[model samples]
Target: MIASPSTALVTWVLLTTPAVEQPALGTCSMGIQHLEVPPVPREKLALVCISPGQTTVINFDADLAMDSMTLDGAERFTKVEFGASTVKLIPSEKLRPGDHLRLTVRFKDTAAPSSVTLLLGVHVAQAVPFVSVLRETRTVESYQQELKTKNEELQKCIEENTRLQVESTGPGGLAELFMLGLLSDDGISSKLLHKNFVEAPTNALSATGLVSYRAANRAALMLMLANKAGMAPWTAESATLTREGKNGMGLRVLTVWQPRPIENSAEDSILVVEVKAPDDLQGSYTLKLWEAGGARTVTLHGVTFPAP
Candidate 1:
């Protein structure tokens, strides 16, 4: 069923389960539907993508509510054209690119995965990333300073005798933990559980965007460092394109994203920096990188590594 809550057109179908999945974490891919941007009834649904012309069959479970749902990224969808399960998209014509939609109710949800089936015509390309004007504004420059402060505090307050674990998330679904005082000063090379949760539009051409790239770099560095060739995954890595500071303390992201390779001609695509914590040190460890120069470090807090 379809309903318009935001005054923005919405379309919906009923389901009985709420199992969100992603591959790396053993979950399914997140699409316009998975994110609940389509404003469907909150229930369990197993959606199959049928592009152009394809038939789909859905089984409903129990009665579900269609009033409150999450569809924050709908603007990223140009055409959420429905397909034919037992029913097809109303308009025989394909929904065009940049087409705005208002979903009004259309499906009735029973508490269980019902025999009700639906087909949607989904499209790729020309969809803008969903960004609300009300979204928090951030200046890239100030981010590093914030990280530096957090890094210092993180290095303190938590040790083996008092080790505190802090978990955080970032763009592209980035996640990792900050462990204070867990390594020998000589063994300082930050390694831990880490993974980057990312969603690229089928319409997306590059995996390199401003925020995602920054988050990716952070994830990559944390993963690489923690792996130290092989330790554990760095689960909570993050970055800012415009962080503050001057040396390693003030790391920032470059504006130029990685583009497709052309010839071997010299092409300086801006610059990126990586921070490395000092080994065997007991102070607050921060790895900072600068585009114009090399990465630097700072001693702010203390730590307590385990015995050999």
Candidate 2:
């Protein structure tokens, strides 16, 4: 007669056999597992779980040579049977938790990876009953998964390219003024300025030529400066535009462009500063420019922008 759960409870109460000590730590597999083993040898070892009195079978895709089988703790197992393409192992009670035994076997036929290795760990919770090792073989499901992954990546690339195309055709700066109908037959308004209009001390850099321009919603000033202080590789760090008696407020500076840095020893360089201008951008203003190290500065007064 087979013993039911209620009968098994009575048998457990009558029996006083010592319990087998379990391992303290192990992430044991709870069910049968399938692993695809690469043909090339890898540094990482595949794992298998084994418990006392539990039978664990390892099935391989290729036949193994019986003579090439090797197990680290072969004597500790209750029974170990090696067939043509399978290895059955029943661990004994002496195999305790935290013990990791190595099992290795070579295939009968010559292959790129001649041998397969596995780490048999004594698990405390559950043992893996079976493991199917596929060597250099992929299922149809694997190919479908790969195709799905590639499709997702291609979709992301298409979306990114569309976004770039839309931005490329959009209006950005002065170069795209024609798109906004700002560049008409009148063209951009320009005015020439002279040295008498400069207010700051011209000891480090002297402004030789000054030109101011005004468009629909933008204003710009271009200045040619002679490097009198011989500052090597001078770059304009900041520019500010402000009306007289404004004290703390200033106009919105858009951008400053310098083709190249002003080299040392009396080299003349060109600098352009652009600012945001509304219809109320009339009258005189002060424009100041400072070098990278703040050692040299340029300031101009009576700077005016003409209407578009």
Candidate 3:
């Protein structure tokens, strides 16, 4: 004989609900979830909520090896697709609510916590649609790796700074310019600007007496700026030169120079910016300068340097 609707509902609920007991080592939740793989492996299993016939996608930050996956009760899953960094699976209707299946995978890399294991628990009323798993916990090996990377980057920066300082210490004038590749056969081409070339949205500083110079692939700009917002002294900290438009290029800024800070007592200060281009640097570029504390900024659009 067929069972009544109420009886079937009760049976389904009973089958899906876990027996009242102590909580497991790992936590499980419904909806989207984010988890971190532990730096040290333990006997506790990470748990994830799943519903029958619903697909749960799990994403990993690192690449996964295809052959390294080991799923318990794999035959009970209706669908399972594994990719390089993702796994999607739908539990079969035969899986009871209290049933827990294990899924384990190994990463392709040699990082610590190289493998992860998850316990997929069937729930009565809830299922996790997506789960993002990250291996952010740093182990001793990971700390050593990070230190090695940082040391390499620092060495590169030190070498570059040393080279720049050596070039800058030479005698001033034509020899200095030649040493830095700022001189060409056409000499230093210069253009004077008397009118306002400062673009809008830069009212914190008023720029005047602007001039642009070009030599080979190098460009320079000299301008006098007065801080209208006299809250703090303005000192140039950084500068950039970018071509305007959809596919415009960005030139590397070599240096930002100023004789002194622009304060209320000293309203105006001379500012200079030098840039290096990969090729002959011509055409108009958008120049942006920022103060020491980044409280004030100035942007000059259509900054055209004289032809070589």
Best by TM-score: 3
Q: Report, for all candidates in order, the number of backbone clashes.
A: 76, 0, 1
Pairs of colliding residues, candidate 2 = none
Give the Å shift of residue 120 in candidate 1: 14
Q: Name every residue pair that clashes in candidate 3.
A: 16-97
TM-score each candidate.
0.18, 0.42, 0.48
Model 3 over residues 1-308: C-alpha lDDT tens digits? 11222322322222222222212223555335667787797688878988655678999989998788898888988998999999999888667657889899999999978899998887632467788787965346545655675677578568557646755565655565567565578766667755546574734677756777666666667776777654677776676577766545667566676667888654467676766655656566777776543345677888876665
Cα lDDT of all candidates, in order? 0.23, 0.67, 0.67
Which is superior by TM-score, 1 or 3?
3
* Tens digit per residue, CA lDDT, model 1, 194-269: 2222321221111121111111112112111101222221221122221223321222221211122222222212
- Model 2 lDDT per residue over 216-296, tens place: 665677777777553556678667677755432366565666777876655567777766676687678878776653455
Candidates ranked, most accurate by lDDT first? 3, 2, 1
Residue 209, model 2: Cα distance from true site in angstroms: 1.1
Candidate 3 wrong stretches, greater than 4 Å: 1-159, 265-267
